[model samples]
Target: MIIMRKHHFLLSCIIAITAFTDGSQQHRNTEDVSDYFEQIRHDPSSLSAFLTAMPKGADLHHHFSGAIFGETYWNVLTESNGWMQPYTIEVDTAGALHKAPWIHFATLSRESRFDSLKQAFLRKASIKDYDPSAGPSDQHFFSTFSRFGAVARYDMKTGMQEFKQRALAENVSYIETMLGAPDTAIRLAAGPAWEKSITGASLSDSTTVFNTLDQVYAALLKAGIGNTAKKFCHHQDLLHQQAAIDDSVFMLRYQLHGNRNEQPLTVYRKLLIAFQAASMDSLIVGVNLVSPEDGVISMRDYSLHMLMFAHLHRHFPHIRYSLHAGELAAGMVRPELLRYHISQAVLIAGAQRIGHGVDIAHEAASIPLLEVMRERKVAVEINLSSNEFILHVKNDQHPILFYHSHKVPIVISTDDAGVLRTDLTEQYILLATRYPSIHYNDIKAIVRNSIVYSFLQPDLKERKLGQLDSAFIKFENQVMFH
Candidate 1:
């Protein structure tokens, strides 16, 4: 009996020793992985592989136009079967697109007609000589889109596919891109055809007159005997890579903007169609009102549009919304307007997320909403470069640090990456540098939050989220322990 007890004790000791040794080896491996990731974090070029390995779940606020590269837009324009443009641009002001206003378009161009026009057009549309110290930098940044819009409208399908390709290149596993839908495309087509008919209407009368405008616009949109619809579908199908469409977890959400330049009722009709599409189709996720923040029309309808959203939300409670609110600051919008924009977006429109919530601190009623956002898990999409360049909101003054303190889930995004001349990796690095309190794990947590905050159908999201976790665990084991 004594001999048997001695043998059993020895066996138990052996097992304990083995476990201790194994645990020590595992600890060493984990430390090694931590060191590797730290090294990669310090090196800008090494970020891609590390980021790809990280379980980056989704890009919640990627703009479709901005997500696409300028090279792609240029290539698309060049390859179009039927595209003609005789205009060009010249820089009126070195860093401000809106300046030198005393000079008219004709006066701005003086060289040989072609060279002058070419130079002018390039200055207007492309980020030719953007300066950091300029007043209202977004004036130049967002204005560039207008120079290229006519060319971009020539083909929509190619643009969508190209955007998807760019998102994938950034190692984004999932995306909910914001696009201007076909309904808006039709209105844009018909806009210039009737310039003389309504040129002299008063602002008050313009609202009532837009009732007639809606009928005409709808009729115009519904015109062409379905051929345009068929053509659009065919082009989209032709360009869409089947494997990419299948393997990619990319989902596009159309953001039909009510052109601030148009009448309120016109905006309402556009919003209604956009809302209806969201209510009816899985492809259409939400309706957003977009245009330049400082545009005369956008400011006029700002409150009226919030009221429109309130009316629409009552009918389609299930449809999701993520508003581009508080993107404006002192120079962008009047200080009086700032207080209500974000409040109305949350209280009136019931936004699920706020894109570029840079001016939240400037808003009077924003504190309660901030608390609500934290409790409700309503995320704020943070696009570092866009916010920095547009609103001059960066460093400690940026509201995201406050949002973090309030526990508001934040998903770092690329608002207009190609347009802003920045990438998601650069944005991430910038945020990390600017807000040093956030750790690597905090970044991962934000990635997870982006997926959770997405407007995707619940079942598929759960399944994909499960797959993401599995992938993350597998990669972590391989990289950290192997």
Candidate 2:
């Protein structure tokens, strides 16, 4: 009987040990599950998926002209009725085919190079090299746009379609793009007609600007690009109204421009007039000075443009701006100009966002300036590929990580996606791989900031943010199960 009791006690000891081991194993597996979830939720596999799943609010800084890509240019230039020009296919020193003599070639027969130009354009068109070691210059970089502008100048249908596809891919729900108005083009095309229109009470009259925008907006809408992407968040029927206005499908925003290199007085007057018209029509949100960056007039009149934005801000406080400032580096602009480009944009011009704030560290009193930006919640539109390609600022050289650490608002964007042969997805991937320490949560915040800082209507923005949250939740749940 004593031996039997001993055996039973041994069996009990074995059972206890087995249970303890099972419990310990379960605890370890639970800890691992938690860690895995954190990584998956914080830094998902695909940056594109993260962006797509992210609730993107707005794309405040977008240029309609630059947003369109090369293939669309090739397709439209080939198909347009009378809009084709002779596209010279010349191989440069690098063995890449590039179109030359833009002015003269804009007049060629559309049918001339229809067959071979498509493939030729693709082969020669520039794409981002994805190399951190090398980059392009500001002048040489922006100059490439002029080379391709001839192809993109044809139609709105192809341009808008491609724009939609890209915006969707980038997880951008809304975009505020700047496009040339019909009147601006007409004035350029018919110099005499422009002089005649402006002779009577300047272009500031809301009536006149609205009329021009109306024609262009109608053309875009009639091209069958309405309520397709999503609902027309806001639309006002114009037939009954005094002067008509037809808004675009997406939460589209507009900005007008004047030549910065032109006379100071001329630039100011044009800006004021444009701002007034924008406020009156509620279509335009800002005015910009676009031209070559290194030109004599752009340099001389840089301060003058900032002064104009400051002066006009008081009158049209409703209008918003995200000016291109500090897109230069050490050698691109004079030393004196570098210190104040971004400063003036923030202080003098009252810019809501600064495009390509590449040289912030180079700017004088930059710490305080960054502080001001942080306090005010003004974001820097970071185009990583653009910075690497144009300014060649890379690795520890780029200040994006600095901005992140300092709690400054930042949004990763594709500055000239088509021109660079990249997308927003590519930018996110670049950031993820380059800065792996910044996990998925931090990246999501940047994605959130993109929409939070966008130029969309307030209500629409809120709605879109809600949708983004839902996507993030869905993505998280799927990863948890897996």
Candidate 3:
């Protein structure tokens, strides 16, 4: 008995020693990699190569339509017999642009004028070669969507496949992309009912507001909105199957979003449909509000939009959402408009995440709000390039470091990568170069936050996290030995 007890103790000690040794070695490896990163941090080319090989966990704030490159949109347009107006480079699927001024893609291709036309189209369709003197950067960035929207939705499968391929190449393991918008028919159908019900009902009166929303909800169901949600799910399933976008190495999920720059009734209907669809579809994980936050309608109906979200949350509490709040700067809107968005998004709308919380510093009770975000684990999606181009917020002026200092979870994302002519790697590069204070382990934690804060199912999230763990082990090994 004494000898057996002694042997058990000896075995326990050996196990402990082995664990400590392995853990210490891992720490050393990470430190060594960090040192190497510091060495090449000043060299752009080498830094790009290093970060490109690093495994990025997920892009939590990606937009599907904005992810497709200009070249891809052009190819889809030309292949589908679309015509482009030479002056504006705007495309029309119908023969609307078939008159003298517009050129057919077939003729351009036949005459070898395709390359020149494509270059011109690229200039207009993306921020490639954009001149700041020509217009406001934000205006240019937002206008690109209209130019490409005619063809952006043509080949959903191909566009998804393109994003997946690009993600895999950049060592991104998962993407929770925002896709789909409110159904126009449903919005129109619910419009009259919503306007009538909400006309006399004060937003502050919860009972009256709730009853009014219920009436609109009933109207939406009568108008076949539920069927619309189901069809949207079915279409997503077909796209996933056709594209084979998910595998052990890469996974994709989607969020249905609504443009907030619409009328109050239209916005509410869209959010309701989005919530209903997300509740019914596993692939559709969450909902978001998109479009320019500084637009007239978005600004005027901002608080009302939060009230709409709050109403839906009471019913579909299981469905999560991330909001594009505080995508604004001081001069972009009235100074007072910037003060309440991020706070209201969290406090009222119960947003699990916030996209482009750039104006956070302007938020009322900013420090307390940061505490709330940290305590509640409301992660912020940091889009370095997009903020720089749109809001001119970058470097020391950017709140990313402030969020980090407050321990608010931050996930770096590519906001309209195609339009910005950048990618996840470039975002990381900017992060590393601009904010050297965010060390290697801190960056790794941020990478993990992308998956942790994602709207993926609990089980799938766990699996992806485990996969990320393995990927990092392999990545760090290469960085160390190679």
Candidate 4:
């Protein structure tokens, strides 16, 4: 049923291998490559130095807000004319809610206030506080978004470049990062009218659901979201152009992120905007659902939200999409909630990829689901650091082995490099150090996996894959014995 194009891939490999070959050593055995990789990893600094320079294909699960460093967030926050003072919520003896706001900078402006609360909030906004002996709860992990939302809200262009620079520093060739609108004021302003106009009952029928989504898309265009989307899309182009000046080798694409915890109508509106944005922009290739997967509102509306995406996909079939499914652990939620998420994401929501996917082992009949994923070629975006920091799953307990064992595709990513205080290279280093079964070949396989499973179109994907293959050949030669 299938024909193997041996020549096509082999031709590229020969071209790559030939560039490094000296007539001899063309068929250097696997042990030579393995030994070279081990020698590189044996160095204490290789994780940051050598691994950083290795050809990383892409980071598919990165979040725009979480990819910026604390210092950058602080700078962006201070760039504002006003100060965003940090606050803590407290309860009194009578159970009355109290807002305790601190200002320790002594009448100092926002920029100077960093000496006081900024560092604390930075720790609060990231895994800086993650301590295995203490705790790394999901609440603490997801709260980082809201903690730094004020800064990331307006820092897209600068943060985009910063992420590109950071990826380049790690030798990553491409990124599929989740980026939100710089300001939601316009989208929100246009929201109420759509909210009042559309009803869930009106979308009960599949045809009606699709037609309603189109109306929402058209209405958003009329309200000028089309212009804003275009502007963001163009800004993405400019960011790419700017980054390419430093290294034309690096590429980035934006995933329109929709908050999943909102009301069905609100979530639908956001999805409509995201789908429309992706449709109108070449730079934005896909849409994704973001928010705490275990949140009450998110749990309540999970199926409804999937239906929304299903309907929207019918109307905007060109846009690629994925879901943040099974980002939970054993005790994080009711057992009933764990069983259906990844299943529904693949079978119902039409997700081409699934992010985190930590609860795979906990799902009912998970083996069958894994088969579905393997058959469908649905890849899991695994973020080891984020998983250990957020879900406390690692080592033997992780389902990575299960996925790998079953031939399920896995692509390692930096879920939130800045927030997690790590990068893609560091994630690869963890894989090498922690998983004994994962050899250098497996590492290269994962790098290739990023491009293979990416939502990027065929032409663009091929371009990046060729770049990756060439880089790999050069990297291999440098690491191997001459």
Measured by lDDT, the strongest candidate is: 3
RMSD for each of the candidates: 9.2, 13.3, 2.5, 7.5
Task: Return whichever of 1 and 2 wins on TM-score.
Answer: 1
User: Model 1 TM-score?
Assistant: 0.73
Question: Can you tell me which runs of candidate 3 are displaced by over 4 Å?
Answer: 1-16, 94-100, 182-193, 196-208
Residue-level lDDT of model 3, residues 1-482, one tens digit each, is 99999999999999999999988998888889989988999899999999999999999888887888999988887787788777766676644546877777776577666788789888887899999899998999999888877576667887888888999899998988887655747555446765665543334655666777777777777878887777777887887888888898898888999888877677777787789889988989999999999888788777777778888998898999999999999899889888999999999889999999999999978999999999999999999999999999999999998999999999999988888889999999999999989888898999999999999999999999999988888888899898
Better of 1 and 4 by TM-score: 4
Between candidates 1 and 3, the lDDT winner: 3
Local accuracy of candidate 1 as per-residue lDDT tens digits, 296-399: 86676666566566666766788888888887867666677777777777776678888888888878867798888888777899988887777777898788
- Count of backbone clashes for each model? 6, 6, 0, 0
TM-score attained by model 2? 0.69
Higher TM-score: candidate 2 or 4? Answer: 4
Best by TM-score: 3
Candidate 4 C-alpha error for residue 183, in Å:
9.1
How would the candidate models be sorted by lDDT, starting from the highest? 3, 4, 1, 2
List the lowest-lDDT window of 10 residues for candidate 4: 89-98
Query: Model 4 Cα displacement at 224 (Å)?
Result: 7.7
User: Which pairs of residues collide in candidate 3?
Assistant: none
lDDT of 2: 0.61
Candidate 4 per-residue C-alpha lDDT over 1-482 given as tens digits, one digit per residue, 9 for 90 to 100: 12357777778899988876743563363457676677766565865576776888999999988888877776655454334445541101111222325332223343554466666766777777665555546777777777666556554667877877787777887888897633334454445654544433322444554565567666655777666666766776776666553356877787988787776566776677788778877778899999888888788778667777887787888789978999988888888888888887888888999998999987788999999999999999999998987788998888888899998999999899888898888898888877878887888888899999998889988988999887876876776635
Off by over 4 Å in 2: 1-57, 81-116, 119-137, 148-153, 181-250
**Cα lDDT over the full model 1:** 0.64
